[model samples]
Target: MVESLPQTRSVSAEAAAENRAWVSDLSSTGDRRELASRRLYDVLLRAARSEAGRRAARLRLAGPELDDIAHQAAADALLAICGKVETFRGDCKFTTWAYKFVIFDVGAKVNRHFWQRAGVAFDEEDWERLPARLGVGPEAHAESRDLMAAVRRAVDETLTAKQRTVFVALVLNGMPTDVLAEQLGATQNAIYKTMFDARRKLRTALIAAGYLQEHQPA
Candidate 1:
């Protein structure tokens, strides 16, 4: 319909059925957009609250904080839904598609919640503690200690400061990229790429140091 009539008309029977389903909701009332917008926001709010509740127990956030997260997620989801309403092709139910964005918003907020409570240090002092993660069997322990030492030297010597922070916080501290980006006021894509590049550098370092093989099998 939007200058892509052929693709729309030739869509699979399943997509045609989905198109029909989209109509039923759109044509339900005369004040269609108004009613639909209200309904969409309400449903999004419920979905956001559902996700927030699931995370709050584990994170131990207070009631007010949980409510705030849900509301913020709902607000963001409403904008997403409204902005993309015209693009809905009913590939899935309206509710299902709408729920996905709310979940995304809620998940990001929950990840950021982790950083708000505490900060992870990715410094030389912390790297010295990395050997603890490699555990207890005297023979294997010796190998672990050696590997940790190599890793420490490789990380400190080979990587730049920014790469070290991204690599250490992500790999060692187990912080998700989204949480790190939010805490640092950066983009998720940028952090992920930095981590990827850092990983490549680390692998190259390990292989060169004889700690890892040049070619690893799947």
Candidate 2:
């Protein structure tokens, strides 16, 4: 008898068929691949532009700057999609899957653009926002202040220099992981690992100080 297993979600028949066509055309040789590549790039470009439009105001990008970022994101996404096309599993529509690549590229580009235009610095305002961001309110203002103090001490005393820098920039200043990686000449995975370690250390410190429960997930 066959053992029962968890069922995996599958795309609709129409989505599956479209996905197959995209994979096939992109994987084929010569003229067919060229035409498919153009079509795919257009799709990626539109997705990139849409995301760029959403982020432009916040990032202070406009006109040529916005267009440049969108175009570059589309180009990068196209390359990424081509390399990973074979990995497509059709759990969603091909366009939906493809759109993720462009969106991520746009975010990375926008972040990099911000850093290039105005570099990040340690700001008291950003630090002040942290307590409020953590849901600390006037109801328990005194207790919240204590928690913030404990967190500050943990950040300064417990974490390593690299960990402290990463946590402050990423968690406090809202720097993107990709931009941080570029600035520090580290891999995105490395930055993420450091952030994870920093958070764990802070959680442990908070727990020891009676600010958090031992069973709580960081």
Candidate 3:
């Protein structure tokens, strides 16, 4: 009775009934579940396509690429929805809850697609441009030279090879973490961890060298 009260208070009767119907259809065996799955995928595909189209310009993707991302998102979202359907509590209509999965998948897939399409290449020339990339103007180079030199020294002296690569690619080169992850054949979390360790080491070195105060942000 208490559980029923919560559902009644939170979900309209129509929404609750619709949610139950969706759950039942999805949970059924054989033909019924197959048909329901197809319908749900179609709904998710349309939503993903809309989102992909909207993001096409920013992602530098054309129609075929956008359609590919949309299809991948919809397929992944369907698997996610099926796996997590038991977590649904009828707080809203089932379709609404399901659409959230598609939206999230679209975002992740889009990031992956963008990173794969846009390469992050780091070279010695890019290394030399660090001062410019960090917004240290030529006029201010003399004033900021010590700080930049300290950062370079710290990076070379304090960090491991992998950490240095991740730091240079992600921080100095303005490469997206996803792009770095793809290039390095690593996970984004792993790339982030490497960057974190690199920053911590650099912060310690700069603080010790008197270039950065202990209170300054890393």
TM-score of each: 0.52, 0.62, 0.59
- Least accurate stretch of 10 residues (summed lDDT) in model 1? 1-10
Cα lDDT tens digits, model 3, 1-218, are 01331265667888887787777777777898899899999999999999888756654577787898899999999988887776678788788888898887777676555445434443445456665554444654565657677777887789997886777656654567886787678999999889888888887887798765677656
List candidate 3 segments past 4 Å from native: 1-6, 119-189, 193-218
lDDT of 1: 0.68
Q: What is the C-alpha lDDT of each candidate?
A: 0.68, 0.77, 0.74
lDDT of 2 by residue, 22-70 (tens): 8888777799889999999998888888899997775556798899899
Candidate 2 ranges beyond 4 A from true positions: 1-9, 119-173, 176-179, 187-218
The full ranking of all candidates by TM-score, starting with the best, is 2, 3, 1
Cα displacement (angstroms), candidate 3, residue 122, comes to 16
Candidate 1 local lDDT, 100-121, one digit each (tens): 8999899888766644554433
Residue 202: error of model 3 in Å?
A: 13
lDDT of 1 at 143: 72
**Listing every candidate in turn, what is its Cα RMSD in Å to the true structure after a full C-alpha superposition?**
8.2, 8.2, 7.6
Of candidates 3 and 1, the better by lDDT = 3
Q: Please estimate how well model 2 matches the true structure, expressed as its whole-model Cα lDDT.
A: 0.77
